[model samples]
Target: MLVYHLYSGGKDSSLAAWILTRLGYDVRLVTVSFGILDNWRFAREAAENLGFEHRVLYMPREILERAADMAIEDGHPSNAIQFIHEKALEALASLPEVERISDGTRRDDRVPLLDLPKARSLEDRFNVAYIRPLLGIGYRTIKELTERLFVVEIRESEQLEKADYEVELRHLLRERGIDPLTIFPKSHYQSRVLGWRGQL
Candidate 1:
């Protein structure tokens, strides 16, 4: 079976897709862009390095604007990020050719975590199975997996060129005259997938 792995050019999603491919699931990487920024280009480059065919999925800019406003209102980004992530998941849910979809969200990832009820609703509404292979795995194991399987680049969130929604959401916040640094939690960092170490 084929699965659409939401690619962010980041280590977690790349690892999820890698595992799926090893299990004989044909996987295509898709980067969701709100059209606010061209960060999807970074994702595409990482996808190429990982040897998966990649494509861009465009979502409405207004949805991001809403998320930005919510973040500013709440003085934090957790709910807003989860909202944007679900929207991105829903955007990917409608592909007629795909029956399964996956992402990099893990056990301890609070922001952007898809709760069971919402996940089931997405599955029920779209008739697609939302598979999250990392949710059952903890942080330390994921770090170990990335260490063994990937060449990675790490940087502070805004400095990295990866396609994680946080990058675009930060841009959206900047557009609204609120510096993303203020709304975002301190000490945030991001990791981009440089390439796989070798075939498993």
Candidate 2:
């Protein structure tokens, strides 16, 4: 079966792809862009290093605008981020070759998490499996696994601007004369994989 893995070029997603590949599944790495500047280049590079076919899916700016509006309305971006993720999965589920959707979400992930109700809803509506291989794994284990498996460049999330969907939304909010800090929580972390060393 084909697994469409949502890739962010971050350690978690990359490791998730690696795990699935080792399991002998046909895995394709997919990155979704919000019509803003993004680190899709890094995602492509990571996919190449992992020896997987990579695809970039562009979500329209309007969709992002709606998500931003949701954040504005709800007074937090977590819900907005989850909305974008669900939309991304829906887009992938439309593909005929995709039998399953996967992401690098770990047990500790809060934002962009697919709650059980949402997962069940998606499965019922799309007839595709939504899998998060790292969901049962803790943050420390994920970090250890990534370090053991790859040579990575860990940096602050701001340094890797545009690497996240929220970046685009923040920019859009700024353009609209709104303060992003009013919506997004302070202090989020993200990373990029420079290369993969054979498993230690």
Candidate 3:
């Protein structure tokens, strides 16, 4: 069976591909670009370094924006990112031989109801299975796995940390004796709140 890893050339995505490869699966890596960053190039280079087949999908900025707008209209925050993710899935599904899709989602990625929200349920909507084998691990665990598997290490991007302004606002509010959830609730994007929400 052929499985494609939803690759972003990040630590988690690379580690997922490594693990699946070790398990004897034919794994390919894919990255979707919205023309905002060079993430697609990174993913391609990393995949080549690991000796895995890689593909890039360059999506139009307008399509991504409209997807994000529709997601928010449907009451999903940070719908832009989610829209991009789904678009990536769709792109992967169009490939000639892929049968399943996997990503580096971990259990530590908990963010209330939104992280695994019904909105991003690819299995239900796309009829394709999305797997997260690292669902119960932490960042440290992913690092350890990468080292053990001899996968190339990826540098963390500061842009990822700065992607969500409201989350930073919430952290500041919490220091002043305010519960950010009471003010903003779980409205921020999953990419923002998933890391810090449980820590708070």
Candidate 4:
């Protein structure tokens, strides 16, 4: 069966691909570019190392821009969640003969409400299965799996290498005993703060 792995080249995602391959499935790797995190090259290397076809889809920047806007504020908007997963689904649907789509999400990653169920629903609706092999596995197990396969760490692109200014600012605020999310206004307000520094 042909499977498409929603990969970010992160430890969890790569491990998901490895497990699926060991099960005798033909897996293809897919990554969505959201402007901020352009880790496409890393994803390609990971796919090549694992011996699977790799594809990258550049998601519309404006959509992710809106999601970022919502996430910066309130930190609990469903819009951002919808926007991201929708993009991933779109990318997956465009591939040919994709029997299933697998992502790196684990049980630990699904504490609060996200669109994971909706993702599964969409997969079913599209006649494709959404699989999460890493759900039961812990982080340590994922690392061990990658090492056993001699998975090489793919180099991140320059854009992804440079941290987003807002992230850096949030870290700085946390160090100063300030919850950036607590004090910073959501959406446009947070945009203004990041704007002063000339970026988000």
The TM-score that candidate 2 achieves is 0.89
Q: For residues 11-124, could you state the per-residue lDDT of candidate 1 as single tens digits?
A: 999999988888899999999898878989999999988889999999998888888889989999988889988988888988788799999899898878878998899999
Question: How many pairs of residues in model 2 come into backbone collision?
Answer: 0
The count of backbone overlaps in candidate 3 is: 1
Q: Determine which window of 10 residues in candidate 3 has minimal summed lDDT.
A: 191-200
Q: lDDT of each model, Cα atoms only? A: 0.89, 0.82, 0.57, 0.58
Residue 136 accuracy (lDDT) in model 1: 94
Candidate 3 structure quality by residue, lDDT tens digits, 44-135: 66566667898766667665556544433544334444455656666776665666888776677542112566535655566666677787
Q: What lDDT does model 2 reach?
A: 0.82
Cα lDDT tens digits, model 2, 1-200, are 78999998878888999888888778989999875775677788877876779989897888899998998999998889888988998988878877899998878878788889988998888889988889999978887898888887775555663355767778888988998877766676668776777632
Please state every model's RMSD to the true fold in angstroms: 1.5, 2.2, 9.7, 10.5
**Candidate that would win on lDDT:** 1
Q: What TM-score would every model get versus the actual structure?
A: 0.96, 0.89, 0.62, 0.64
Report the lDDT tens digits of candidate 4 across residue range 118-175.
7666676778887778787776886576555543433322223322223333444455
Ranking by TM-score: 1, 2, 4, 3
Tell me which residue pairs clash in candidate 1: none
- The positional error of residue 75 in candidate 3, measured at the CA in angstroms, is 15
Q: Give the TM-score comparing model 3 with the true structure, all chains together.
A: 0.62
User: How far out, in Å, is residue 13 in model 1?
Assistant: 0.4
